[model samples]
Target: MNNIKSVFSINDLENLSGIKAHTIRMWEKRYTIFSPNRNTNNVRFYTTNDLKKILTIAFLNNFGYKISKIAKLSETEIISLAQKIYSDKTDSNFAISKFKLSMFNFDAKLFHETYDKLLETKDFEIIFYEVFIPLLDEIGFLWQTETLTPIHEHFISSLIRQKLFAEIEQAQKNANFSSNEVYVLFLPMGEIHEIGIILVNYLLLKKNKQVVYLGENVPMENLTTVVHHFNKVNFVSYFTVQPEEENLNTYLDTFHQNILVNSPHKLLVLGKQVHNFTSFIPSIQCFTSIKQMLNTI
Candidate 1:
């Protein structure tokens, strides 16, 4: 009862392995690296084993091993080579390749092991700032280019979110919580992306500050109600895709006029949409990046 699906298309292979369909076809014809099965209607399809093999081959190719050398290796030999590659401390490409393979196969154990190994030599903040953020950005690009599907993005993001949440929880457990200025982190209505806001909450909690996280798609009106009760509350939000560009100015204007103008508390904003009104943005300190905001705090 493994319940694993078998058949996959060329596009699926490309998405899972990061090997272009055209390139895969070329490898098949020119190098005989892979031999895919054809359906009755002459459509190319690959199996689970084929997907694993291609990922292993892609990992080897990324590590400077020529395609010819990769093709000559037996399946057992390829697995052995991947195991050896995983042990190399200097090979970030190998680690990233293994991470991709884990994501493709939904192998959480492998993902955790690889991340833990990386953490032994690199700090979590460095990993987050240098590796994970860039990887997520690349994932976004892949999504835009139709190289990955929503399912692929969601699966990987969910795993990352789990890790972030665990770290946040541990930080909260050790927090001193002596601050009077409690931050209330939230996303405005229609904004379901909460990863950035979650990270901010984590940062605040790590600093031992009280954080009230009202996660994703929160109504602005509801936030106003909370602000009325919590006098020491500082409202923080991330605008990734919510409040469409056309309406961003209106939203900010209303928010500034109603919530920020008379209130003693401050509003901290970040993400791409914040740039839309940079010229018209009030003299109040609103950060454009997490680093800027963290420095101010």
Candidate 2:
């Protein structure tokens, strides 16, 4: 038998649910909704169940459910109501709510079921371009608004990474390496966000292109070495945060001077920072979207 006594401190709740500590305390005092336990020292602590309850409540509140009505529901009833709300076909709002619920509950089964249902009716491209991308955009907004925390982001991102990896593996089996142009995928130094880069790699491999993925935080000097070896190379990277806004011009100038200007190959850059180089970007080739980049190659 497993112990059900694992306690989560108020900090844990804040970290897991993105709800402010003061706000959670106010809710506790103002309403009889959340009742956390006290340790031997009389310090309050929450449970996994409490985290789930708060997540459900937050989701409902975001969707315009009155806090008064939400506080009246029992735990079981709350879960059931969340499921009903998630299943309604109104819009992407419901899907986003369901995805958040899955993250809060750590319910991989629910995540997979919801994703598979969407996949069944829509093609993978539609699912990626329409559903997954929009969901991620919403997640970004929630994070910025402090409506979701790092824990919530990591929980859902890991699941999405798993799905991407599975698709990549399947694509690799059929990928053709006979071509001379090998695409090298990487993220610049100090940049660790690889989800977008990984998805691009998956798409390239799916299209039967040879891809060499150096992953995150790759040094520019090391990339120069790769350029030397591959006779026909197209280097790709996602520049989310490596180069600060002020230094973006310098970074692009150095890249153009050192790599793209002289080399016979091309360098494809994406992400928000790339917008800084719009004027100076060489007509050789630059892409803003994955679909456009893929089409070019």
Candidate 3:
């Protein structure tokens, strides 16, 4: 709790707030929204307070609140209005800001609070797609830009995983796997992203389909033993940065021959790598999104 970053650069602000650095500078010049503390070298940087205020403003701005009017309000008024907007739950931007702050500060309680607040007006699936997906997408770019450390990613990811587990557990209490085809969820070898797969698992369970979650970085050879357990099954996988573009088709061919040949089983593919898929096999299916896959299956 005490070890989170105390300072951020303009680029960091741009990335986190979704406001360009020039706009931030213009806001400062025109409205004097928040003062940035300059370092010894006279470079512009922002304190954690500046970040919180920007997120608050951005939350409202995205929801139709004007910056000109926002600049006219007192800090207390701004916070109070934000709270009212939250209570109304008309937009996910407020929740997204809270989630981002939780990730940056490594605050589990804040994450849970935000999730609970969203749950009051939204179902788990709505919250996942609306708030969580955008937050996760931003964090991915933030990590790639070196604006956030892996530790930051892991901390927030663990909190989200906890919620997913809780949701999945609650759904499982009334387990009904009456579907004819069993679903096996996994990620390809060398792929470590598990959040998408877990979300899919939750949805599949919601559909009353039996699911065998093999998890991330699963090798092709290791799946034979599991597939033999079900008479007819669908292998669901998310391909996020595991099989390189050049090797993706080869990987698919290997899976088709090794696992799906002359069998009633099929493979369902999801994730970013599916965009490169030019041709299709009879048994292998690629979906553009989780919702599409859910609807199709």
Write the residue-wise lDDT of candidate 3 on 51-100 in tens digits.
88999998888788999999999999998999998897657888888888
| TM-score of each model, paired residue for residue | 0.82, 0.70, 0.94
Specify the poorest-scoring 10-residue window by lDDT in model 2.
1-10
TM-score of candidate 3 on Cα atoms, chains taken together: 0.94
CA lDDT of each prediction against the hidden true structure: 0.77, 0.75, 0.88
Off by over 4 Å in 3: 1-4
Q: Residue by residue across 69-127, what tens digits does model 1's lDDT show?
A: 87888889988987787676445656666666665577889888878988887877776
**Residue pairs with backbone atoms closer than 3 Å in model 1 (clashes):** none
Candidate 2 has which clashing residue pairs, if any?
none
Q: Assess the local accuracy of residue 142 in candidate 1 as a C-alpha lDDT between 0 and 100.
A: 63
- Per-residue lDDT of candidate 2, residues 1-297 (tens digit): 322224577866665456688988988998877788898999998766686677678777777887689888888888788777766643354455567668656688988987886665666666677767777776777667564567767778888888888888888987777588899998988997778889999999887889998999887777778877888788888877777778877876777788777567777888877754563565235567888788887
Error of 2 at 49 (Å): 9.4
Cα displacement (angstroms), candidate 3, residue 297, comes to 1.5
Candidate achieving the largest TM-score? 3
How close to the true structure is residue 30 of candidate 3, measured as C-alpha lDDT? 97
